[model samples]
Target: MQNMLLFFLFILFMDGVSGADETESVMEGDSVTLHTNLTEIQNDDTILWMFGPEDSVVSQITRKAGLTSFFVTDKERFRGRLRVDQKTGSLTIRNTRFRHSGKYKLTVSREQTTIKIFNVTVFGVVGEMDEVKSVSVMEGDPVTLQTDAEIHSDDLIVWRFGDKGILLAKIDVETKEISLNDDDERFRDRLQLNQTGSLIIKKTKTENAGFYELQIRGRESSQRFLLFVTGE
Candidate 1:
């Protein structure tokens, strides 16, 4: 399916398509929208969103007299997590999971055929598995590293950054309060935490690409996240 899509798109745009929104990286349980870059869809135009490897359909959009209808194709696989923008034909996947990671093809057909491909990566939720999972994010995009475990009432969760293990944020579940350490000023005001013990880095910077550790104080378990930043 992937090969067929690539070959068909290559034939359609032999010269190439400009500025295809090609890559997106997100964490598990997050939402991502792939834009079609169109201000509006004409009545005669039909848009199809396909996911490959198998090249299965994700959703299709068509317009009638004055209204648009969206048909979600792989509903069982996506479990009703797909959405589309009526005007732009952009597709959004809510509460994304690892199985949602793949290449998506957007085909806009009207007077002519235009194709765009997007590569999406969904990082697994950090757990006590103690694995160094690789995460990718675009510069200036916010990325979150979330844990799968529920916050215990008495747990003190600590999030650390970089190889030096700089303190980033500490969360107190008992008090529902957080203490942030930005003495290095690198993260300054771009770091935050959620009640789920997730570390969110906003406006991601290239230097922020490194090992991130999540540990609960007094526990012997820890998990690491290796992040890579692109497009400075």
Candidate 2:
């Protein structure tokens, strides 16, 4: 799955109608900017910056009726992390994480479409983080782990389970699609991911007690949930 996504973006980077590509490397938790090289943005120009395999919009600057607007995606990964240079339409990612390492495409639209592609790689390995929460639930009861935050219109949320980090469920904001346990039957129909990216385990059993991880694309960090199903 990961390779296929990389290939898809590779094609876009290689064979676009018009583009200037650049490579960037920054340490984790640092800031990096992708420049558009435009001296000034015209009132009729629309600048868009997208990231990741899904090409989700991370930031944008647009003008309509002489009204200029700057918009950044409110995704958890990008929360308080992305900034746009109003004058030049450059995009900056602050406090970068490894997940931020991906292809970024900038599209400037007016009479002609100008494209710029950036392949960003954030260095440094992330060690295993300490578990932040312990959840206890009774067998045969439903347990919900709440993320308690609203994501961007097109945020990608991935949920994994157990010590092996098994694929449990995913919420694709771009397509508004949800899939659960494609390769694991232990979850089967028992897993439910809510709109807010929370996980609901129905009829959870004692065996469900384990480690679970929530990965929000664009997130600088993830919250680990340690489930302890009781009354087995």
Highest lDDT model number: 1
Model 2 C-alpha lDDT per residue in residues 64-111, reported as the tens digit of each score: 887789989998878989888888888889999756765678888876
CA deviation > 4 Å runs, candidate 2: 1-16, 125-232
Candidate closest to the true structure, highest TM-score? 2
Backbone clashes in model 2, listed as residue pairs: 77-218, 77-219
Clashing pairs in 1: none
Report the lDDT tens digits of candidate 1 across residue range 120-146. 867776652245566778889999998
TM-scores, all candidates, are: 0.48, 0.49
Model 2: per-residue Cα lDDT at residue 131: 32
